[model samples]
Target chain A: MKVSSVVWLTLVWVLLWGTFTPLTLVGGVVVAVLVLWVARQAPSTDRLPVRPLRLLALVGYLVYDLLVSGAEVSWQVLRHGPRACGAIISVPLLTSSERVVTLMASALSLAPGAMALEIDHDAGVWYVYALGPRGASDVERTWLRTMDVQRRVLATFGTPEELARVRRLIEERVA
Target chain B: MITDVVSAVLMLAGALSCLLGALGLVRLPSLLSRLQAATKPQTLGLFLVLAGTALRVDLKSAATLLLVGLFQVITAPVISQIVGRSVHRSGGVRPEVLVVDELAEERPQDRPS
Candidate 1:
């Protein structure tokens, strides 16, 4: 692994788990910095560049959706019964990167009614099971739209053209 | 004591939401729908639980709890995205209303060799 990748991973680990123990903190910091140095020597330059304002908006939207849908699903299960639930829908993806794809999966899964089950990297697809009043078509559309938002956000970090191309590809495949 | 009561209530609510979400996961028909059930309640439930814990605990632990919450808020979506896209790419059918398949166009080589 590149030093940069290692560094970033370490930094993330420390940031997330540093509170667990002093040893973890020390180890995380040391390993992270060292890995970062190695990553710097690596020669891959692809990055997802996202605008800050848009990113914030995306986060806000996700949070709101999470709350609303969480309540909706909970209410449905409580009032109507589980039989009203919808079917599993498979969503094809434009982006192939693990980070972007996983982010998409986690986001959907974290929502109220959906659970992302598997990721087929070769096919660039995500399988999600959503439970709600919506039909299969509606669910698929929602998933696509949500992923579109993520694609746009990813574009902000570095390569707009690449992101656009990815978007285009996903659209074509679905068509 | 009042603060403790509030904390207890929040914790209970959080637990309820979590339970509801888990139930939805079991009851939901589709994987996509289940994903919906799994993500939201877990996030909110966890947030509430953390908040309640913070209310009842020391400052450092509270800070840690908040940090964990923030992490969940950040990473949850990313994970969903990955899973959703993978499902789609795996030949999941799309709605008729959809007009385009961008991913397909982008990768001509994705076709079978």
Candidate 2:
């Protein structure tokens, strides 16, 4: 089990119990280990490569995006009433990695007006469902915004080859 | 005293956002659009409420609430994605509201005839 996941669980355990004794800390560790062990009983998936600095950058962008998107959607929801010009757009996936696909899926879902409705990692494509008060002109723009997110995800965790392909794809698609 | 005021304001803001998210959920025309509203602002509301709670609590309890907030941020999107995929595959979306369906065109096999 990854030490970080275990430590995180223990921290959560400690906080939930609202106690800070050595015995409780030790007990938290035991419980965390047990939880990890149970999680391991399932089929193992490929390990995702996480570069801390890049992840920190992603987190920073997500925070900013969440605030902007939340406020934007909230405004649209209040003014336009949720039916305003929404579509499910198909986004081309540049990377072949399942982990990378998963990364982009979660990140895109949280980033403002777009939520990933379907992901077909094998076919190198996914569908994003976009919602907002955007008019018809903005449909292309919304799809392009979702592509921009793919670029960021590739930059953060993708291999050099994958990133290069993404760059090429961006030039072809975005430009 | 100042901390108390800050906590109260933050909590109120969180509650307002949460309320807005719920309203969006009810008001959205379709399932896909509703998922967007259910996840984004609701996630923010959660973070704000947790922060407000952490600020008002003792040190250890504060740490606990902050940890909970962090986990919520990490997991909320994944859950949203799961729900979205299930809905999409099940044809839960209203076909009329969709102005574009590029995925359908690309995969004719999956396209509904």
Candidate 3:
């Protein structure tokens, strides 16, 4: 039984009950155990070992990202107005963990100007339907920023070995 | 006094972000892009607004607000996913604008239509 799953199940159980009373707490334990049992029965996939400090840094980065990108996108939209200049770009991800991929995908989607459309889990690729063209203007910029979001997410949840592999992969791509 | 001022600031910030999102929706090109515009600011904006509300309210309500934020975080992406998939398959996007159409490749049957 994963401790985090137990804790998360209990949290949800409490949230559903809409209380933290002794009665609710007792009920949560029962619900959580049942939920955990079901989860155990389900085919378990991989989970990323998230780093506490790294996760904190990721949150800090997202706050900064949200503020900056909010302003940038607002300016772009207001200035340029709507145009049929968007692109569907496939970004290759290095991390094999589904949790990491999903985390990065959602985080990418959470940022302004990037919407993740699909995840090719076997290929470790994410099809990002983002804001602008390749390098002509706004779409390219959005693509880079979206990729940056993924890089930051990978840093947050990746183990040391995984992180090193990503570093090398990025370097190879850059080279 | 300081706490009140801080809460007010947070609220103002949230309102500004929500405004930005609305503006993006109005100004951005496509349905997908517009949906993209609606997401971050809306989520973060609402989260901030809820945080401000929590600050103003008592402890019990604050807990409720926290739970609300958690649920919002969990569900918002799912909503976006459904919306994106529907729009893509239904040809809500301007086909010319899509630089790459891999989905068309995956579902070859979808191409001619």
Candidate 4:
């Protein structure tokens, strides 16, 4: 496998293993760092040039969103019946990079009351399920806005053209 | 002493929220709604539980709980999205939606048999 793939896999492995076995966790970390270094040195198309500050902001935003949404879902359950919730919405993604697509899907899914169900890599689309609000338009608007954040997050590592394509696709679908 | 009381309160609240969320998951009408009930409260509930536990536990256990919380925070949305998307793809119609799906229009031949 390519260095980048190895690096990504090692990082995933470390995250997965680190929670359990201490010895394997240390080894996983070492391998992850080493593979990352090697991947950085290797020339590749999948290279992720991330903006650190922007990434930090994105992380902060996600955390805040998760907390707020968690509370909202809790309140909804407490107040009204969960039956009041609505349908699943499919979000079309713009970036073709596996890393970016994966990150976006996972991030959105991790948020309270949201799920990343399916991804069509070829079409650059994501099917998301979110708690429906009063109006369908409201749900669509909220989802599109959230997707806009995802687009910006992906743009940090990808080209403007790619981001523009994603934005355009989203606008075309939502509008 | 105050911290202990605060921790206990948070824990109880978290546990209650989690139980409510799970109940909602079963009570919700559609798959999408159920997912909403399952994920959102569970995230906060788990976070609260973990936080309370962390306060009462040692450094290593706290670290483990933190990792678990982070993992749940990260993975929950992805799983929900996957499930939601599948529901949409599986011919689950949105009762209140009015807008015509352009992608559905563009792909006339790929409709499920």
Highest lDDT model number: 2
How far in Å is the alpha carbon of B11 misplaced in model 2?
Answer: 2.0
Native-referenced Cα lDDT, model 2: 0.78
Error of 2 at A68 (Å): 1.1
Sort by lDDT, top down from the best: 2, 3, 4, 1
DockQ leaderboard ranking: 2, 3, 4, 1
Identify the runs in model 3 with alpha carbons over 4 angstroms from their true place.
Answer: A1-3, A15-19, A34-47, A132-134, A137-143, A159-161, A173-175, B97-112
lDDT of each: 0.63, 0.78, 0.72, 0.67
- Those runs of model 4 whose alpha carbons end farther than 4 Å from true positions after fitting are A1-45, A78-83, A88-92, A163-175, B85-113
Clashing pairs in 3: A132-A139, A133-A139
- Please say which candidate is ahead in DockQ: 1 or 3: 3
Who is ahead in TM-score, 1 or 2? Answer: 2
lDDT of 4 by residue, A1-175 (tens): 3555665555566555535576766677677767666667435368678689878877887778767777777666666563465434566677777777777766666554555666667776665555645566767765775576677677676678877877887878766
User: For each of the candidates, what fraction of the native contacts does it recover?
Assistant: 0.37, 0.74, 0.50, 0.51
Candidate 2 wrong stretches, greater than 4 Å: A2-4, A41-50, A133-136, B107-113
lDDT by residue (B56-113, candidate 3, tens digit) is 9878668778888777766777678778877777767666656666666665555436
Predicted candidate 2 versus true structure: per-residue lDDT over B45-79, tens digit per residue: 88888878878877877877777777776787788
Query: DockQ, per-model, please?
Result: 0.26, 0.64, 0.53, 0.42
Q: Per-residue lDDT tens digits of candidate 1, residues A1-175? A: 4555656566566556636577876787687777666656545445555578867876776678767877977886676554554544456565655556655655555555655555568776655555553454666665665555456545543256657766876678479
Better model by lDDT: candidate 1 vs candidate 4: 4
| lDDT (tens digit, per residue) of candidate 2 on A1-175 | 8788889889878877888789879999999999999878554466566788887888899889988888877886898784555777777888777777877888887787788777777877788888862456677778678877887887788877877876777678656
Scored by lDDT, model 3 comes in at 0.72
